[model samples]
Target chain A: MSYDFYMPVRVLGGESVVKTQAQRLREFGECCLIVTGGSGAKNSGALQDTQDALHSVGVAFEVFDRIEQNPQTETCRQAGEVARRCGADFLIGIGGGSALDATKAVAVFAANPELSADDIYKMQLSASPLPTVGIGTTAGTGSEVSGVSVLTDTKGVKHSIKGEQVYFKLVLADWRYTASCPYSVTVSTALDAFMHAAEGWLGPKCGEAPTAFAVMCLPILWKELKRMYKTQELPDSEQRKRLYHASLNAGFTLNQCGTLFPHQTGYILTEHYGVPHGRA
Target chain B: MSYDFYMPVRVLGGESVVKTQAQRLREFGECCLIVTGGSGAKNSGALQDTQDALHSVGVAFEVFDRIEQNPQTETCRQAGEVARRCGADFLIGIGGGSALDATKAVAVFAANPELSADDIYKMQLSASPLPTVGIGTTAGTGSEVSGVSVLTDTKGVKHSIKGEQVYFKLVLADWRYTASCPYSVTVSTALDAFMHAAEGWLGPKCGEAPTAFAVMCLPILWKELKRMYKTQELPDSEQRKRLYHASLNAGFTLNQCGTLFPHQTGYILTEHYGVPHGRA
Candidate 1:
């Protein structure tokens, strides 16, 4: 027996991947926490499509559509209670990492209940969580690709849920969902993905999982994310997939070695000032 | 909120990592199922150390000690039942990928009995497993870094359990453990990690997250695994860490793009004749 690795979520990212995957999600969980970015998913018709998919699956769900940027601990706790009360067997963290992180914490908290926000730190008694699936409307965060759920605590302390058990059971990446993203979001998220790769490469414990591959892909992400930030015309999946792959690598390495320098030090920025979780 | 990318297992490899990590396992699951190779971890004293670790944590465990090379479906099913009957909350797939993969499947079957070995290949599913921790005494397979769990079905068809849910919460790697690895297994597994990097680079999905970094790390793993196979004395964590890092990248890349022609074609070789799953 060797070591184990987990990413149980079935990820599908493309034009039709959302609907196709929604069909699959129907068979699995109970009520979902249909997390959205304030109101975009509702307005963009993606929410309607998602609802349509849920209806097709015949699964009941409620939306925690009010998740704000850089979700606060209070919000996650509220979501947790809702999930617990709703008897939500499965959680769908449908928006970006904010909602997703909230979904992760809420699912775990709802299932276990005893673990408060305080227990989520690196050293504390923690249990496995309720099953979850992610839908990426943006390509950054790569929350879909990792197990660490970064959330801002009430005191604004960024707490990261560092176990693989928190990885989403499914990550549906519909590039089309991200296509209409505000230009600012695209650049920032892509930059965040690049950072995941860069930090992973530079991190102290970067293991032999193949660091060179991650390094090589860095330039591509750097160039392209920058280009999209400036040009705004998106790269096709073939091109974008490279960075996605790199982001995943970055996630793997960083998760192993952990984020070095900027990431570790960035907490000061987030905690002291009012910097957003992703930017700092 | 953008995507958050990461490979979630916290790895502690190089010589004394198992012993070092044993302290932390107390924070892992309550009960662990020590999944081992056909007596390899025992002979190496790794099993004894693991036992000591569990005992120190005041944790309890049972061993599934009969895992074989190129582990088959029956092993997983049987082990899964054993784990279920034992009510094991945590599992330690303690040797290489065979034991690890089998242990992963067993955890899955133990959690969700309805899904058969055959169902995994068609699509990724919830392998509802207890929190699993993998300790790699051997650095091949890259199983520590991947969620792809492969097992031969009843007809000897190699099926894979793919997704994040099966990933280990923590991966403890101690190069010292490899001190007793048979020269050949060491060679093959190292080569396998090498192939994982090479093939992942060549595959179509090389464009995904951190593939560049993963791609770049290949040679380092190739170089060290080869040297380790030849000399068996590369205790320098710096060097071994490089290989470990490369393998992690390769694992991430392969998980995304998978092996290209070689992996696809190798399946036929196994199906028609009888090539070992790792034999390239």
Candidate 2:
């Protein structure tokens, strides 16, 4: 009967949107911290595209390439230190869920350097985090358009921080990043996107806006998933584009209504069974 | 293939949302100018609910109830002068499309008193306009959710001023307002909502978010339209609520993609042929 709605992030999608929208990165600041995983962003050429875009705009950037799966709090703190040392004014997260999630925490810790990682999970930040932009290299987590950041703590417990302050100011979704993903990785990630839309649609908190997002996303995801299952291969560029946009829609819906029991229960599968996040 | 998306306005719908959401109005301002048509808001009890809510919060307000169908520039200027004299800080638009449209213009002129009505249409104001809250008493026009204000000029031509600046910060939609609307008005307005969704879906400028909106809206509008045509009488409260929400969805879609040729060509039907906008 009652709900508050806002999806303030601007999402740009298509082939080469990252390069096309490079000029917009200047709005964040003059200097940037590019956060990525071990080899995903680099191998996929997403990092190069981002770097080239920043270079074209006359903006300088430093890369923090050590973000890991289910990004650890310690890793975020380490990345934040690098960002602080580089005097980076903004952050561009250029990999999958882990990098994007870690970037939000890193942006916060980088802005509030005096605070420890535990303090981030325990207390609300008084200071605004550095403006962060998401260059989504994968379509699974929908993290590019979400404000929620899940990071594993020192005790191996996963904790999440969420608020409007943590959302990326802009998102660049480039489907080419998924072109390099292993079939298992691609299926799992695409399933996660489907789960988000399904859960959001059935969730009690689901309202008109979120429902619209779910309705838009699920069909596209279903079509792409069907094609992927039939071909037993990676989708063509056009199909990937549909899947990419569908994932963004699901992420936006999740941002509004959140995931239901599956997300919480699925964590056990991820931690205990060594399942990939999307598979879990 | 490419798009920019934002529909940040919070829409509260149902029978008593104005009274239920009275406290939220405080976010707009303390002192307010309430704008409306001659009798729509009053006869529908929407004005009284608004007054009760403002009184509960101790917010002061003045009413300008002279807005006509296809709101005029001169009327808006006069209302702006009254608002200026009263030292109102924000505006509450509480009637149909014309009142809501006029309120947007009044807010702009009230903030920038130096500008003439012609100037309001001819040039964008350098300063931001007063914050506006819309309490939609009718289901058509979607003015409550849109930034475009269609105002008739001194030459009697309808000119629109549109931008993010004119968008309402909040919208309160009470189907009770449409409870009093004649079946013809209800059907016509509902048709207008349908046209927006259809046109937006088919438009060349349409993108993912707008297409999502059009998809969500068109079905609800069609169902409501079918019910109205069969009943040939005012709908029950539940039906009215569905129609109102559908109209708001249509308005949101229109805000995103805008109406293509039908809206522009339909203006002639409204202006010269005496057709209701939805029918046109």
Taking all chains together, the TM-score of candidate 2 against the true structure is 0.89
Candidate 1 lDDT, A107-174, residue by residue in tens? 77777667666665542445567788777666667677676887777776777776757777777666
Local distance difference test, each candidate:
0.67, 0.84
- DockQ-derived CAPRI band for the predicted complex in model 2: acceptable
lDDT of 1 by residue, B144-223 (tens): 77777877887877777777676777777655555566666656666777778777767655554435545456667667
lDDT of 1 at A110: 70
lDDT of 2 by residue, B151-259 (tens): 9888878889988788888888777788888888888888988988888778777888887778877988888888778878778887787788778878877888788
Q: Candidate 1 regions off by >4 Å? A: A1-11, A42-45, A74-87, A105-130, A142-167, A190-217, A225-280, B1-11, B24-39, B58-134, B137-139, B142-170, B181-185, B196-217, B221-280
Question: How do the residues A144-198 of candidate 2 rate in per-residue lDDT, one tens digit apiece?
Answer: 8887999888887788988868888888877888777777878889999999989
Model 1 chain A lowest lDDT segment of ten = A1-10
